[model samples]
Target: MRQRTGRLLGPLLVLLLVGAGPDGSGETVSLDGDRPGERLDVTLTRVVDPAGRADSERLVAVELRLENTGSVPYEDSPAPAAHLLDTAGQRFTGTAAATGAGPSLPDTVTLAPGDSASGFVTFRVPAGAGLAAVQFALDAGLGDDVGHWSLS
Candidate 1:
């Protein structure tokens, strides 16, 4: 009986995951100026699933494009401090990398005016947590200069 249940669960899980649809749709977000002369353009390209099995947590990688449109250069990185927001209002913190899988952002990115950078921000969320959007704080933990991308 136990063996039979296990066989059935595998297919059922696959079907459920398939029906969840592709990575969160791309969205554009404008970042605020942490200082008087800082502006940025952010685009959430897509949200991808982990290539390997997610036995513990569902680690999703968010692809993004960051452009500095301000006069001063962006002297900080956007990957290590990114966060994810789900439909249920739960927030998932971002990770530098997904253990051993997924892409990564640069360590020290300095985007000058008109310069742009593209990379991934990984987040570890609970399995099947309906992700609604991604939030980025330009100043890391400063809670200033924020940009939000709606996945829905």
Candidate 2:
């Protein structure tokens, strides 16, 4: 199976080493369409909303939705980690310039072949910090497949 690697927003890409966990399940997305003669389809959906928490801090509200759109059932991949980056090459969390949690959101969820779940990532930004963009990617390092790599 070809390894899947992607960048978050950009640069903040999610690096998932192969055999990340239990042998990966489910089929790979051809990016073209569903396999021939197959009646089952799986889809991963995500929504990212950045909101201000404090005067100098901000948080991005991310909602991940997984659904088995087809008539069949199969194990789904884990979602990736979401991160935020600034202009000066600094992680969003509390560093020298910025002061807050980068993209270490608390997400412990897994959806069944037909079930759906949601999670959130809290980003703490310091006052007067220059933020360029937010990134998202599946850090297979987390030992899961729901990296939810769509909102990029």
Best by TM-score: 1
Where is model 2 poorest over a 10-residue stretch in terms of lDDT? 30-39
User: What's the true lDDT of residue 142 in model 2?
Assistant: 32
Tens-place lDDT per residue, model 2, 1-152, is: 22344434455656553332121223232111132221212222222334446665655433333343334432322223444455566654211121132232223434344554434455565655555433332322232222212221
Which candidate comes out best when scored by lDDT? 1
lDDT of 1 by residue, 40-100 (tens): 7777676786633467777788877888888898877676557888889998877667444
What is the C-alpha local distance difference test score of each model? 0.65, 0.35
- Cα lDDT of candidate 2 equals 0.35
RMSD of 2: 12.2
The TM-score measured for candidate 1 stands at 0.72
Model 1 alpha-carbon drift over 4 Å, by segment: 1-24, 51-55, 98-102, 141-143
